[model samples]
Target: MSTVFDFAANLLGGGEKPLADFSGQVLLIVNTASKCGFTPQYEGLEALYRQYGARGFSVLGFPCNQFGAQEPGDSAAIAQFCSLTYDVTFPMFAKVDVNGADAHPLFKFLKGEAKGILGTEPIKWNFTKFLVDRKGEVAGRFAPTTTPKDLEKEIEKLL
Candidate 1:
């Protein structure tokens, strides 16, 4: 697939949903985990989604266990944790590998569009973020350490 809209992913506790469902809206796609040190970033991500959702922006979270085995939970458990712990209300997808032979196609396209440091395509850790513009273009990539709040300006720019 070319643009992210060309791809699809299984939503947590739901059927597969096309990325096109978010077409025309700016997107923040994140590889999330439940038990990592960065797991608390889920709060900031939810904040951003609540603050900008009405402005045609959304956050898409994909739980991943590839890093440190931090997200070792099934769909139901993940959904419950995100909801009860962080009050996360954003769209969340099933667990996926962000870097590997089995990496999701959307992530493969995202990495190719916005490589990390030294133009590396591999995701370094959990919470790695890919910002997508309204046109479904991968606009920017943020490291796992980059908090969701730090992305406000860029998200505003896209909005």
Candidate 2:
């Protein structure tokens, strides 16, 4: 079976990073947007990363413009905004579509691993998060409304 490590993504700062590089670590993968209402979640996510990062935990952020055009910035703008605004230190990727025909392969795998409300596969909005265990297996999926702070317990369990 294809594990989460079977995928790769482009980093916001440039270059590609294979998910296999993060194998054996607990991962919190999120589709983010700089202008969305959930943008502030970056702070919480950063906190989570800081809190559990030493314990084999990581947060991989993927910017997306699919929802309300909330993330219209280019990679440079996205990188600058994240650094200056939330001081986010987690790894962030270039913008990608999380729904429809143009969706990223990693996201397609994520949605398949953990369906949303009522078993729906399409992501409703940005900041949708998927939790992956140390084995690179999808553990759970959280909606846009699920705050990163609320995920600490689950993350601890995986650690």
Q: Candidate 1, residues 39-156: lDDT per residue as tens digits?
A: 9999999999999999999999999999989999999999999999999999999999888899999999999999999988999999999999999999999999999999999999
Per-residue C-alpha lDDT of model 2 across residues 1-159, encoded as one tens digit per residue: 988999999999999999999999999999999999999999999999999999999999999999999999999999999999999999999999999999999999999999999999999998999999988999999999999999989998999
Output the number of the TM-score-best candidate: 2
In order, the Cα lDDT scores of the candidates are 0.96, 0.96
Model 1: worst 10 consecutive residues (lDDT sum): 1-10
Model 2: weakest 10-residue lDDT segment is 150-159
Q: Model 2, residue 131: what's the lDDT?
A: 97
The regions of model 1 sitting more than 4 angstroms off are: none
> Candidate 2, after superposition: displacement of residue 141 in Å?
0.3
- The residue pairs in collision within model 2 are none
